[model samples]
Target chain A: MQTLDQERTSAPPKQIEDLSLLGEVSHRTAGVSRLEMCIQCGCCGGSCPSEADMDHTPRMLFAMLRAGMRHAALMSNTPWICVSCYHCVVRCPQNVHIADVMYTLKSMAIEAKLYQDSTAPDFSQTFVDMVEEFGRSFELGLATRHYLKHFPLRLPNMAPMGIGMLSKQRMNITPTRIKGIAQLKAVLKRAKEVEAAS
Target chain B: MNKYILYPGCSMESSARAYYDSLKAITDIIGLNLQEIEDWNCCGATEYLGIKLTPAYALISRNLALAAQQADGTRTVVAPCSACYLNLAKADYYMQEQPVLGQHVNEALAAGGLSYKPGSLDIRHLLDVLVYDVGLDTIKSKVVRPLTGLRVAPYLGCMVPRPDYEHRWSDYEYPVELDRLLNALGADVIEFPLKTECCGGHMTQISPDTAFELIRRLVSAADEHQADLMATLCPMCQMNLDAYQSETNKFFHTSYRMPVIFFTQLMGLAFGLEAKDLGFGLELVSARNALAKIGIEHPAEIPTGTARPKKDGSLPMPAPLPRRNMHTEKGKVVK
Candidate 1:
């Protein structure tokens, strides 16, 4: 896995126009239009709480999308780093849904198999797995699997908090399945089929 | 009694048990009748929607579909978790606004022999329903302990107020509903300038340094204002600010233990509910010092401003930038 530094220094992939990322995304979802409306304003970046940690600021990512650098934008840590705080979306002068655009990039990234940096993506998948398994989340299980996978070293530091929570009866060790888990799974399976059909 | 459906997103069961417990306790006092949506799944949170749209929306909308089935003329569905509430409301609003998306989502719902018409259910955040539906004055009437001595900085985080399709929040940038609600509890509500600021959300898990910067901004700002504690409405915000505070402090070489508790938890406390029942000790940063204020006679007034002159001559926070009115010409935003 390339470190964030490597990811940042990595060149924008030879400006390939095999597909216009922005155009493809807009075509897929009509909910977005203001992509063409971005004034290249720095509102999204400036308002982003985690922009400094991102490989590309939201503004730069948008510019890359407009420039059709799909590979570069998709591989960047920008989309993965977004916490969906939505500060930028509401603050955008042009009313561009910056958060939604990040969502689009994440979907595109997953579809194209471009997310080589795996910590955040893995965390997301772990979360989904927990939910999918029981219909409700299992935090202790999710945290153990996640930290032991991506961040074993930090586990010791996090143990005290975990212990505190456990002592307080805050951490439920058992995974509780929703009564309609079968129905939820069916809906999810069908949703995937619908997505694939589209 | 105000009746509505409650979708206690997964976190309410495990990580935010305090929130779930306190919300349950407060509702009884406020006369809110919440019908739990039978067998609701996760709301897909902030993670799933980014990974896949249809399935994620379906996962969230399935809950909506189920709520619609059980609405029985009470169409409102309230979620206490900000992310769950946002996802549910977004699914409902976007499905109504876009036909193709709605059709695709409903197609998925059909497999489970369930279907939800767009706008069939009223999706709302718990804070919205409490402040708007319950009314502050009515809440004020029930506050047995009046929280007079405890000074709280009302932190709304980012989700509850923004992209409000229902036009419920008073203002997107600087919503005063939380402040008003806390005031109705008779707590001294500090005029927190960063009330609507991002609480770094899941960045605490993904990038610790980035999350610390955001957390520090909120915690230190509250500390600077001499707030006894910081109260928020979102489970995500409480976890980030309260649980990760010391980690943030360790990273930034600063020491701050600004107690971040859920607003509903505070509400339960003011309604004369037991602190243990409100899940007070679950917070990594203890609110005991702040809560202990309840024991002493209530202070009539506590001054809020620069606690003392900054010896190093640090300037006060800059005036907030004026919002750009969207109706103006393209070039109207001055650099």
Candidate 2:
């Protein structure tokens, strides 16, 4: 059994620049390799509840990639609909790390400004902003903001619903910020240093 | 006393006040000192990152920087909110994973005169402290009233265990920490399969249908399992499952009145603390009936009709199984 440090040392470096035109934003080693480990066994697609709705299932995505259908595989909505349940990761016989790959691919697709969806990007951005602003996700604030961003027209209609939610104390209006923002900043810096070295 | 820096995030004051209150009460009893990080900010929950990557992480990193400054040699920062714990842990993990991303975030932090060294602090969920720091044995020793015959479904939600930076948890699908804790308290813990499923996160706002479908699965699963109540470590999970059960029911044209409580509340109950002290009355789905099943009655009376038979027909009887010694060293179970 290899120690965690040994595993890290033997693991391939995450090469961001090698993953298409998105350049540094796309992690090649982390994304495609995660997809490559899939034996096209369909375990992930089989277990995925959302696989039916997806244009290309996770298994098909991996199989297509292995067959050199890069454009077709990259263009599909297979990665976007993933709920990140980690069911695929847990059930994977080959330790394919599908969810992580999906995340990396999604990041790449977003950076490349491809596969633009009205709701997904807005949702992802809203999530990122919540973390950035307060060091925590304020669900009430996030839900309200996400709706406004994705469905601006729906805001007026949502107001009554929002009020109803607030009345029931289901939606909290105030946002909570984490303490010691400085230490968090340092950790980010150190992470940058490590990333730069890698 | 183990002094830890506490990051309450925003929900603790309002939506998750019960979790905040119960955590404070439980920690006080365990002789643990929790110091709140002064003037922390919101951890972009699940939205900010969806909008923009660099700025979103930078925003969360700022909080970690402040936490490090106030560390006082206690490297562990405990977050009661699942989103806070996930965001903080993700920022820390990714900063080490991607350098350019970390540099940009650090530059953003420098403007605030605060910086953090990656891995400077061990960001842990409050559940971790209770099970690991306080130890199940210690908690068991303090239980004035074992939660005799109370059936609980341990709901972890998503976030905390996944993208797990420190590997402080067990199997992602079925982490037994909370289950083990409840069992130690003598509660009849249910083996809930959807324990780690997503609670729709901010999607409850973006698309209620989508959110409702996800929430329905969890509630129905718990209901299917015939769990008396659900216990959660994440405020969002608790908030979504507890606060949205009615709306979700309306949307799905189904009825479910499952009470969701913070795990700390159950801990308080096992310790013989009054339900009110644990903020049991604050839940949208009243825990009164669930408590009544265990002979633990609450002041707010739940309608008698809501009480149903345990799914397994084993109500008021502990599941017949060999009892393992509850007090084991941390990380031993994982190996």
Candidate 3:
């Protein structure tokens, strides 16, 4: 509920105080080559749909990693803005797992408390929490909680569409849970344990 | 009847219930038997994979383990949501490509007495199975009313084609399977250049400006080509391009009411199914105008020259360029 809480007093933005995000991401993506292979060919940046909004191009971010400018790279909004489109990964000359690299960067940034854009992270945490609780995402619940928490002004604007969906029976208020949620929970717990232990 | 397991991801149950309803309505007609997995969990989507690696993989693998447990003889698992399909396929592909990842995932699986072999089951998107396995001939035979007047932009979004891992796609950047499928149904299919483009998945909920820019590009392109509606295979794409379309237009100060709909819903519509059963009115940007072109409510009338394309036949698909690493102007794919 920490992430799901609606009344978040906006925290003051801060520059990244650490410089280990690059090494941490590299460790997460070991064995099958890593981000170090990026040729800085600009393929990822070229194919990016949201590149205009990103503070650093993906290629530039890779350059930052190589140059050991961890603070600047982590502070950039590139990782958060990535839509996971995978346009760069499949198009890369060196076969860099660009999208996966972004995922790693994002997770590391959140762990280091570097990311200031809370909306994307909040949405992710809310989605994970929904899955953790019911084994499935409840749409009305997720959307309601998300908008009410982050953008209350947007809800009234969305009412007509919400009513339209409801009238068509597309909006279900109750989240249907699988019968074996206990077993699912056990698996998730063990997985978390295994991840932590590693 | 063809039998396979179905993994209707979480979206198909709630936000994409229209997809679920329409898919169920057509499977019987298409001669498919989709047996549900006994019990499954969420795929964690793109989010969980970002937050935590092992737990995310484990969360997704639980479903595969359960599906393997419930296989009974069939090994193919079909997921309707693109995100779910990609996540499921990634678990299988990556677990094999990197063995240590597999070892970690299985260790987590061992806790609940569930385990999955990387190559045990073939995870497929519903569109792939429908297009390849079901074939286009059977689909054409079943279309009671051809979508003669309605022009459609077949949008496959980003995930399904690229990073195919299994070599299942015809081309990475511009796969013509959806366009061909829509063409065979007699709709006036356009040469939509952005068919395989990104829909800024989950970005609408994150950054409205970035998402709207992406949405505006696709919507405006479809509108520019004078397409009556844009048909899609992924629910996330459909929701972003359809439900949030109004918001996107307002943000951009544009007024394009292009309707984005699921391909299966369009298939259901062409199969002579009722509009209500096909989940027509669920989209925020209503398809009434597009449907009216086909005379859904009124008497079947021939569309005027303005509504028709330059030619009566479907637009020819771009020539398949040999795969190369170099980037170009057209949809030439690197993979």
Candidate 4:
């Protein structure tokens, strides 16, 4: 039933256009990510606890990367859905650094402005803003501001828990700035400059 | 006594104050001498790393640099929080693995008048220090009150074990370090396959549905095992399971009350320390009922040859897997 004629008539594989995508991700990942060693194994997808929430499995995302589907890959919710549990990283037969690569994809998505939803990115940005400002995370402020911007209706529901945590002295109402705030800011400022230059 | 520099992460001062309090209550008994790293900032906790590379590493490296400078007689830096432990260890490992990263991070640190040479300090989790350094035999000897009937499910969460760059954990997927430690405290540690599962991390804020589902699974698993309570080492895991249990139940339309608490609190209980001093009532989900299961007197021993025969056609339950000894000296430091 299988004939050489059918094989000859079949279309050729799509040419990989965005070859820099893999290089960029691997380079951005810390240490040797081993992204190039991926063998299309579905271990990363299978091991992911949050795979149900992802629009594309890591394996599928890798395929898309190979096919040079930059827009589709960047817009996919796969990277954002990652919990960074490292389950896939350990389970990957090829030893691919799946979780770290997800981090890279997230930063790249933010850079290209190709993310489908603003919730995760906004949370990360807000968290970063708090860290940059006070050198510590103010959970109450983070929750209040994030909920006000995204889910105002849920604020009323969250009040009881907030009151409980506050009354229990579990969370501080105000942020605590570290003593070396000025020093940390200088280090971070220099880090940003170096990152931008590289 | 073994000495180590303590890096009590941001959560210790905030959402996980109970962990800090209970840890302090038991340290003297276990002989863990902790000198807190002064003016230590947050490790950027799983967020800043994704936003920027060099700055995030620099932020974590600052602590390492501080620890290195502050290391008097001890070169071991112990972090109680799982996220803090992983971040510190990862920064150290990566900086050593890739010299270019070390150069960039050091360049940034130079701006702060600080520089860290990779592999200078031993970055370890508090749990690791307790099991490996303090030894379970010593912990058992200090137990004046045994948690005999209270069944506990040990939850380590993510971050702590996986991506073990230094090869510290016995098995990345199913490490038994926490389980063995809890067993030493006289609690009936259950067979919890979801021990190392993710607690949805920050998804509790970004996507409530995702976090709820994951939390529901963990709670449901413990309930299925007939666990009286769940014990966790990570504050994030405890917060997600305890603070969000009601939300998870509501989302699933199920009425299940599962109490989640830190391992240190249980350790304090076993050491005969008062519950109030260990920060018992701070958990959103009340751990009172679970704590009540600890009887004032030990139960009388059952006579031998009183075993009931299995019913016809009833399948035999599989035996529990043996816990591996992860105390090997290998992989203590990566060269």
Candidate 5:
């Protein structure tokens, strides 16, 4: 396993076919991802609201997965671009769980440290950190930290709306911690253990 | 009164407080006995599910476990937020569908001295409960001040209807549940093609350009259809279209003032509840002009200078569909 820094700086690895890629993604998904059942029908791509922003459409990414192009599959920005709207999941002729499959691919990419963009992963991490800490999401804190780190220039533009939210009391200045934070944290910790064991 | 467990998500406490407030007022009028699950944590939203599967499912199921424990005589758990509803429903559905996943999640729950049987609880959205359980006839009977001429674009967003594990929707592409409910309240429901379309979700936080274009599409479509305002079921949809409308305008160099609000707020209005009680002025884009059509003006709403467009020169919009006389059969609403 290459370090994340090395993986980013080094030249692309030779395309050695990893035949388990499709099944691996399927296994990681909570329910049957049905990734192997994809017919490349383009329904997923056609129905995707964010297809224009993705490097490869979901259909193309599935084709890559079938070809065992693990490096390419993990590096593509398609999964991160998916908003999990499930438009493709309902539209797919084969009943493929396209959105859940995207989640599996995202974790895999994060595990391999092969994704091209860090914006989505970092955002997800920031959100999860707040959830772990307070047992609930802190929108004000999350937005502040996220904008300051990623889009410092856009902070001024975001101020008017922030002030409106604050003045109207739509968002709280301090995060509200849940009553069962200790219990919730224990469950999360044990969940990680179970995942590792599996 | 029909009773159930209410899983008001984290947003209900913060950004979506209007939804929470309106829900409280309307539930009293509609006779929905909603008992909140005690000490429930967040459902992990769409974020944790992307990072790790087991932990994410476990985190969401923690709420399910709590709701299950607190399920006195009611097996039903209702969530008002679309993302929260989807996550909770997905966890229950997937746990039953894949027993191995359920077993692993239960292992995590053991640490917290909790275990939830996958199929023991029924997860439903608050809209589903309002329409199906409470019945449209009941909702109509309570309308003291009908929203007669208010043209509303009933936006359900994506999460509420799609991948509907329980087959609870009218149609995935264009669900008429919200349309019919609004019509019952006397709003002129518009022909909104992007009703089930994505409202950019978390893209506003991760990628503003991508999110802005999506928001622009929904808002522009609602405007083209000549909707006075867009009424939505999800707080995220309300926030994105309401809070981010100006930013989207700046990005696209277009001025579109479409006030996005929660459906419950509108329902509260139709039921003769005070605007303050229904969280009328909290929206970033003021709904004053829209409500003014029905002779209901919010005190805190600042007046906008933009004149309403004359309907003559623009190509005629397709007439809004006739109101459906709906009846539920085996948990599915049919016209």
Candidate 6:
């Protein structure tokens, strides 16, 4: 796996047409119109709780889009810290739909295989594994697997927390899969079709 | 009479059974028909969409499509689980927001011989329906056993209110619909600051300490408010607060036995429904003791002290506003 640093240095500037991935999905989704409504106001940036942590604020991102600086927008850590709080959309004076735009941007980045993060993919994978196996998110299993996947050496560290949760009967160690896994698989298939068509 | 397609999710059948039972009982009493979507799948909850966006959303959207197909006329889809509600709403919102994602997901759906028309259904959290459709007046009327003496801290969690696509909730940071519902039930609702705080969701599994710390803040705040119990609409919040209270205490080396019950369960009790029938006893942190404090021995009997206003009509009303001087120093008359 190439580090984000390596990808940053080696990757060429992403062209605006590369954003077509977003257009494909955003077309059928209200997210596109929401993105179009962005007036480059700083409400989304100003309202973000974790704005300090982001390399580009939501406003700057829109500004980048308007300026056609696709590569800079795609490579920033702004999308990762969004927290998906629709506060930006709620607070925007011009009704700029910030959250959907952020999601589209994130999707575009992921599809381009740029701006790789160590934790997000593992977190996403853990979620899929749980659903595929049990037709739902097994909290304990997901937590344990996520920690194990991300921090292999921290296996023993989870004991204190695990025991703490276990004693309270919060951590159900026994895996409980839904009755029919085929139904979940079918759902996955259907969603993929939606992803493709849009 | 509002009819909706119900997506009970997995927790409603297992961990949060009381939510399902009480919602059913109350909706029935209110004359609302909740038709369950046939062959509904898991919502991917808090974790799946994070792992693989396409499949995670697909998994959730598949259920929405099924609910929409199953909808006779009503376009609203109601989910009791906060994670389920958020996932369903998020998928629907995103599919419309990102056409490429919509295309990809639709293509995936086509493979399964199922396609979803975006925006076909309005996804609503259970609390939204209770507050909006079944107004407080109607809820107030059904109070056979008022929770007058009981004090409850309403917990909304992070998912339900935020990113509220349908505008179902109040301010994301401090929603009061649950508190309003409880107050209408005659319970002393506490003003909790961490009402919309994260219950660590699935973070408890990935980072126990982080989850514990978050849970501790919520539980501790409720305890500080002298709340008799914590009322929640989200199963994940209920699970973390109820099932993990003892563990959180152990981690912090403190003791807390606060019972976490579904808001619907408390409503069921207030509605004079059977306590056992509402699955009150099924909770890991039993609410039986709390129920006893309100003079509710069993669900059948109307608890004492829950009577309506006396014939004399002498009930506490809001204090009348103090008379204001008509003229100001500048000789401007206040309207």
Better model by lDDT: candidate 3 vs candidate 4: 4
B119, model 5: CA deviation in Å? Answer: 0.8
* Candidate 4 local lDDT, A1-198, one digit each (tens): 223244346553355547667777889988788888889979888988887767779998887676556777788889999998999988899988888788888888898998878988999999999988998888988888898988888777666667778877878999999999999999999999999999
| CAPRI docking class of candidate 2 | incorrect
Question: What DockQ do the predictions score, one after another?
Answer: 0.33, 0.20, 0.33, 0.38, 0.46, 0.24
Report the first chain's TM-score for all candidates. 0.88, 0.71, 0.84, 0.90, 0.91, 0.78
After best superposition, candidate 6 residue B252: deviation in angstroms? 5.1
Q: Candidates 5 and 6: which is better by DockQ?
A: 5
A-chain TM-score in candidate 6? 0.78
Q: Which stretches of candidate 6 lie above 4 Å from their native place?
A: A1-30, A33-85, A92-120, A147-198, B25-27, B51-54, B93-104, B170-173, B207-213, B246-257, B281-289, B297-335
What is the C-alpha lDDT profile of model 3 across A1-198, one tens digit per residue?
Answer: 122122135342234533454566776862254676777789889988877777778998887676555655666788999998888878999988788888888877787777767888888889888888888877778878998999899888777666656565566878878787888788788888887888
Best prediction by TM-score: 5
Residue B249 lDDT in candidate 3: 74
Per-residue alpha-carbon lDDT of model 4 for B1-335, expressed as tens digits? Answer: 88899999999998899999999999999898999998898899888888889999999999999999999989999999999999999999988888899999999999999999999999999988898899999998998888888899999999899888878887797899988898898989997999999998999898887898789889999999999889998989988998888777766678778988899999999998888888888888777778767853322222222236778999888986763322233332311
- Please give, as one word, the docking class of candidate 6: acceptable
Top-scoring candidate (lDDT):
5
Pairwise TM-score winner, candidates 2 and 6: 2
Candidate ordering by DockQ (highest first): 5, 4, 3, 1, 6, 2
Best by DockQ: 5
TM-score against native, each model = 0.88, 0.76, 0.87, 0.89, 0.91, 0.72
Candidate 2, A13: how far from true, in Å? 27
TM-score of 1: 0.88
Report every candidate's CA lDDT.
Answer: 0.82, 0.71, 0.82, 0.86, 0.88, 0.71
Pairs that collide in candidate 1 are none
